[model samples]
Target: MRFPGKVERHAGRARDCGRHFTKTLRRAALAATCASVVALTGCDDKQQVAAAGPPPAVAVTVMTIASHGAAAQIDLSGRVEPIRTAEVRARVDGIVQKLLYTEGTDVNAGAPLFAIDDSDYRAQLEQANAMLQRALAVQTNAQSVVARFRPLVQRQAVSAQEYEAAVSAQGQAQASVADARAAVTLAKLRLERCVVRAPIAGRVGRALVTEGALVSAASATLLAQINQLSPIFATFPKSNTAILDLMDEARQGGLQLSKDIRFPVQITLANGRAYDETGEVDFADLSIDPATGAQSVRARFQNADRVLLPGQFVTGRFRIGERQDAVLVPSRAVALNAGGASVYVVGADDIAHLRQVVLGDQQQGQWEVRSGLATGERVIVDGWQKIAPEQRVRAVEQHGPGPGP
Candidate 1:
């Protein structure tokens, strides 16, 4: 009975050991699965790290620094006007009996432009001449009487009172002859005025008064307009501050305005074409306009071809001075920020840096760098928006198409 009990104990112990071994194997399998998962995760991490490299390079357009002549100019607008313009009017009241000039024709000075009905004027002139002739004959008779009376008085052939009366009558007759001559001269002047004439040589506008129109001296309509075409004037308004600055410059000898008061001027017509003839400064206003606070400047240009007309709107560009050794860049390279204008400058490491720049006048679609930019600096014009400061980037050289000859 003891042996059987011992055998049962041994069997139970064997079963318990088997169960313990099976539990150990299951725990070992679970641990191995966990180890494999951790190894796969570590491999994945290494592959991801190897795959992640430097950022891709940015594509951009750039221009190299170059030296060129830059001109400083002032831009303004103005209107063209005739150097001399006059309105033709009548001086005497009369009927427009004749029209001597066609509309829009050129007339010369002292040329007969119109003639009035001068029959009455001619008659008056004739009457005055007849009176003058009668007076001359009477004066001749008086002279003879005076000569005879003087001799008679001297010889005591007649009383002194009678000789004095004869002398007084001769003097009165001479005065009447002089008065008649003055009347004849006055009549001739009036007759001459009857034929209206141009006072100056110029192109004449349309005539306001026609033939058979009742006209008066004070109430006569405009006969026509005359405008001088050659040496035309360009009138432009400039700011008072600009005038003051120019004057200050002149005083400081920075500008040779006094010796050469005239400056070259270019005019842009309304059709966007530049005028063939260049102009020169003629006159500057002495006082500022009270209404606009601007001064008027007049420029003269020879317009023999009559290409410029009066009252035509035009734009003007005046070269004020020249900028020497000025640094200029493409206008597209300039970027505006919170502070001011800025540009992206490429460094030795091919990285971009922001540079603040001061700009001046624009010429040929390029901005003049007054300061903050030097020669031989590469400025990024395109793809700037994609770049950030201090970021590593690959820079590819961008070349512009060669300029035309």
Candidate 2:
């Protein structure tokens, strides 16, 4: 009986312990399940929040298309030159006596340049005059004899052969007088040549031959050089295609070639300063250079200030026409990508898109857009690197108006 009671008590204690272990396990499992469900829900909520947000906005400069007249121009480099240039030389062979004009001075036409030895020339003139007088006296005597012989021949008092000889003598005297007159004329020319004169009104260069230096007419040594400074010439080179285009425009009445082209010419000097005076297109070369395939065009400018010097290199611009209703943007707006030229345009949705454009000539710090952009479209001119294609951006109004006139 005592053993049976002990077994029953042990059985009861084991049953109670088994019930407690089952309850604890159930509670732990319930807590673990609830934690997993909350963690998953938090992750899903975070992902949803991230997807709803947009990409960062790009700060960029924007410009609008404007309606205005802008000129189309071709730029070229050339050299400044005098309108007229002449090398002064000695016309008569003699020792230089005096330099009549100072070096590098402005001289007028017919102004004395240099003086040669006139003493010898004067003596020759005197000799020529003396010879002329003697010839005149001899001619008078021959004429008197001829008159007497004519009458004698008619009256049969003188032989016909003698009368013929008298007539011949008179003819010889007349030939001698003509020869003397030529000699006098030659002497006068030589005297005039003794004083070298400037052929054109211009500025004179340095004197090449000094006083007491013997020079010859055939020698290469020049006395001086004169250059006409006012109304100077500028020679610039342009492509043959450009010339043809200009001609075509003239024929179409789009441009009047005969009118003064000076209004559109702008000159840039070597020092990067703009020339004050305007120039007119004076001449154009008929043929193109085979090597360069370029035609030279010459322009004339009134250089009254004498600022432009000969042989000075200068840049010039010739306005061909005015572009009407053209779209212009700042140079910075055009981006050079691997696919030629492109620009970033902000659409109405404030989203950026890369636009490929055809660019024409540049004018006044802006590029002339030929295609791919229409009026009223906003082009990003600044802050290009920060933006990308399809990226959302806030379009900010850039400072100031569009570039160029």
Candidate 3:
């Protein structure tokens, strides 16, 4: 139906269409190959990521709580107090002439600490002696008269009235002599007291009166202070309820109370340091304080090194008795906050859990876990700061006393 030349043109157009179709098929094949390669690469990246799991665990040192016989104790805030405190005051009226001892130094009993003006006392002593000498002279003259009158009265040469008068005069002279002797002794005593001396062996405080300061004996003129430092007393208050509770616990077998009141005691300084020396319970007041409902207790401590000072705030623990099957953890494990005391525990699954705890008396650098914890549980002592609650950790056993820093 077509011309021969038209047919040849149509055949050429058809050939060009076939060539274009072949190029489209090659491009489609190339696109499919690239998509398959991209999918395989994505799968490999996903598999690699899946092979790597959760983050590595943090390393920590933990302790497994255990039951042990520990001292059942009562804790209280206390103060360092001198066993004896003496206020050095002026005993006689005089001007301060010299300071005999250095301030803040140990002084023995009878050691002179201050010297007052002794010149006036010395003059008074001489006056007393002169009066005593006059009394002695009068006494001797009266005795001579009595002797001369006695023989004359016996011989009937002197009147009875004269003999009686002589006897009365002698008695008066004797009484006067006795009074003068007493005055002389008093004057001597006053002269000796012009030098102020320590009444007890103690540490002397700073001199209150300066040189040339006038002092009076009638009014209490404070000169200095002295406090016994060795074998000091520590006083604390314990609630009456606490005492009753302690007795009840002993009755209930929760504790075995020490029959003797001289129980062991320990002290903790204000700076958070434990005092090296130990103390003993010396006294416990039977009567309860009406204001605070507390009983006063006292302990004696030997402060040989003079490390403890009076009026220093401190903490104390009284070993009331022994307890059985009590849980204890290293002191380093406990943490305090406004919420309360708490500790971090490591589970068998290696997860950290924070637990609030009730604390009891400390023992051997360990804190008693009163409540909120169970035996055989591992508590983080060291390396607690490295991890937090719910975090995984590698727990290791602690072997030493406790953690530091």
Candidate 4:
């Protein structure tokens, strides 16, 4: 017969085992359901992505590129300079007595600019004049003696040695007179220099020396500066490499500069405004500067309003030459990166293809494509950023002169 405690313990043991098994089953069922839901979500996401299909064709504005005779222009950094400049300085030693001109005003060539102490100069000039008069009196008396001796020597009335001596004395007196005359001329020049004058017509700066200030001719003391503002010069440097390339291109008959060789230039001031006057390249250095490896170029512009100033920074656009059968595209259409300059070309299949282009001069907001593009090719100028290379695009012809010529 079984004991009552033992049978109850066995039954409790069996009930605990059944409860543990039920918990295990419920946990496994919940985990399986969560896994199934995650798998279905992943399948739906992939199907949605697949159903979306290829990306929609990007809409872009394109231009059908064709050859046109466009003016070739190159922009270079430049500085505005006066066509003529002069330094007003003391030419004779004296104390500055008066400033004859109004500072910062325009003056004509040889206009009086300053007045230096003239009392000493005048005294020296008078002394020279007195000396010259004395020498002249002596020369006249010696000439009369020579005239008497010349006739006496021929007539043998006087000793020949005495007549010869008298002739020599006249020549010495004449030479002394000439020497005095030279002294007088020098004195007059020195006196004139006491009144300083403008050496050139230009706008003069402030006087460096005031009244009573001593200036030295030996040191060439600077008194003021003047610069011609009208018909000013815009000086710039052109790259030596560019010059060489241009020469080569010219030799190959691929480019033609202006017939007169005076390249037309346009100036842009520091304020980002175009100058009213156009200029021409008047001078170019014969050789490249060794330090900078650039050729110095000068352009002259009529600055009637005195807008261009000396040493002012500016930009110069040089119309160097023209190219035939050239391809051009809007500047904005080209993208520059580490790889190089490239543009989006829309193929006949309506697919945008990235094309590498060799660019020449950029004129009027348009780039001259030297290579990598041909006539009849459509280049995407607008909405190019939205598409990738070889991607289909809906090209619409751009209206108006979008960027420039």
Candidate 5:
């Protein structure tokens, strides 16, 4: 524990120098570690910044909402009817001999439809002719006697009473011939009526009487029914309110139809399909039904193909007015919910905006927008689910079904 002073001082200096060197080495190592940790933190922040980028734009097919100004269309329930209907009846009293036309077939006017038993009529005609011939022969003989008696009476060779009797007999025979000729004419007319013919050119229904059935002429017998197929009629009962509304529309210039112009009409079948044939508004009843509070409207449709039959239920449509500068969109574009109909309209900046629209009558695959849309505006039709409201989008122009309203 005890040492010289110089030796003790040198030992203390050596220990101090060793401690200081160790402390200096530790500080240098700590500084190097902190520098490496700071460099790693800077690299991590750059990686995160590179991973985060702006959202991609959604793509969609859009149709510009344009004003297809057309006459306003009103659809109403109706039924198909025949243009003309006639009841085929027996014209002469006789037994039904033959049915000339097949049941439910087309027949021309004046074409023979039924054949009645003409045996009696034929015999009566023959009898009248025979009687006329007999009367003519008698008249000729009486006339010859009268000619011979005329000279005898003047010359006093025969008695005047005998000559006068011969002249009276000739007159009686001549009168008999005239009556017989008139009877023959009547018999010929009766025989011609034995063959019943069609009264009009149309489709005939089932035959009421079979062959060998007795038909009376005095009673207009029902034989069959005929209906005109081509140019059929469709009658629709329109409510009084609707009629008044149309009149109001006309007064406001919503509808500008000509006085003599027959508005174009269309029909839809029960299967939700447009009828192949188009019709025209032909008649509109002025008087309203007190019981139903509706007016009857009629339309004429060309049924050359006979696709539409009488009594068939249909939806008749006609132009009640027009919509100027109206917005029209595809049927598929609009979406429905409890809040009513709405559509996704793409803006000029390629942003999708959800908009509510008022739906009107549906046209050819397009909906007539009453409000909430303007002309030349882009409405998304195809890609609705691609984005939500306020999301960016890529719009593309498309020529879709919205051609006419």
Candidate 6:
């Protein structure tokens, strides 16, 4: 029921629609092909990345272990003390008449220090002498009577009993004279004590008693103090555990203790200056202190310059022994953790391996390896914290004063 031209137009529109539909299908296929190609390229990139190895070798500084002589040493805080200390005391009861020596001066032994009032002692001595003379006169008279009575008794002019009485009287008179002589000697001794002298040769401190002050002999009143400073003492505390460990090491032939066990000691003053003279260990306490678990060690030093003073504190370095085959590393190379101490050891393959080390003594920024390390092994001195165990590293050899031969 339509015209032939209208039908042809409709047919043409239908043909155009078919062609557009075909073009749309072709564009959709091309888009899919492009998406597949892009996906395949992304997969290949991931595979390439997976084939690559561990990140990169970490850079670290390492030290090589070797046999060398290392000193077994420890540093401790010490207190200065005088070799000998004497407390000057009053020996007699009297008023102090004069102080002979100046305060804070050195005095020789037997030098006069103080003088006390001696009037009473002098009077007592005089009385004793008079008593002795009177007793001597009485004995002479008794002896003459005995001589006269002895002849009379033999001639029957006196009774035997009377002669015996005369002899007894002579004996009593002689005893009195002896007793009086003893009293005189005691009085003289008391008088000598009135003058107080230095009991030792050393430096004396301030006078505790002044002129006119009363001092007592029975109470042993302290007048002053003297301390010998030329040969001084330095006392320091050492840990008992450390002592035992050193002994054990020595016994096992790992350490060579000094002969006679008299270790050498050196001290640094509180002002950070080194002492001129070195000291030797003189005395060590037999027992350890319960509170501190430490042993007291005393060293003697010749302080000719009198630079060291009592009650001053100093730092002491004690060299107890030496290790023949000692292995040492920098203190920075050691890492302390819950399992005690550890370090990073680099192997021949340049791989950093964590090693548990038994530490002995530390000195001059170095630590002595007692166990868990051997010779020719390289230990990481730097960049240890930046690496993990069994990780490859670019080890840089450290030089200058090390455990190397």
The reply for model 2, stretches above 4 Å from the true place, is 1-61, 66-69, 242-263, 330-344, 352-359, 381-393, 396-405
Native-vs-model 5 lDDT? 0.87
What is candidate 5's lDDT per residue for 1-405, written digit by digit as tens? 866998999999999999999999999999999999999999998888778876778789888866767657888999989999889888789999899988888999998889999999999999999999999999999999999988888899989999989989999999999999999999998899898888888999889999989999899789898999898999999899977777776787656545654778989998899888778988989899999999999999889888888899999888755766556788889998999999998888888999998998888778888789987789998889778899998888887444542
State the lDDT of candidate 3 residue by residue for 280-397, as single tens digits: 9989998998999999999999999998899999999888779978888888788978887999999889999999999887667788888999988888988887777899999889
Give the Cα lDDT of each candidate. Answer: 0.82, 0.85, 0.90, 0.89, 0.87, 0.91
Question: TM-score: which is higher, 1 or 2?
Answer: 2
Candidate 1 per-residue lDDT, tens place, 1-405, comes to: 358988999999999999999999999999999999999999999899889976677876666665555676677899999989988888777889988988787788888888888888899999999999999998899888888888788899988998888888889899999999999998998789889889888888887888998777787557888998887999999999887786686576444343455878898999999898889897888899999999888889999998888999998887766655667777777887678899888877778888899987766777888788777777777778888887655666555422221
Model 3 spans > 4 angstroms off: 1-66, 330-357, 374-405
For model 3, the run of ten residues with the poorest summed lDDT: 396-405
Better of 1 and 6 by TM-score: 1
Q: Where is model 5 more than 4 Å wrong at Cα?
A: 1-68, 130-182, 336-340, 345-356, 372-379, 386-405
By how many angstroms RMSD does model 1 differ from the true structure?
10.5
Deviation from native of the Cα of residue 316 in model 2, angstroms: 1.5
Ranking by TM-score: 4, 3, 2, 1, 6, 5
Per-residue alpha-carbon lDDT of candidate 4 for residues 1-405, written as tens digits (9 for 90 to 100): 869999999999999999999999999999999999999999999999999998788889999888887776788998988889999988899899999999989999999999999899899999999999999999999899989888888889999999888888889999999999999999999999999999999999999999999999999999999999988899999899988887788788777767776898998889899887889988999998999999999999888988888999999998887776778788889998998799999988999889998988777788888999988889999898888889999999975337762
Superposed Cα RMSD, model 5? 13.1
Score candidate 5 by TM-score against the native. Answer: 0.67
CA displacement after TM-score superposition, residue 163 of candidate 2 (Å):
2.6
- Per-model TM values vs. the true structure: 0.71, 0.74, 0.77, 0.79, 0.67, 0.69
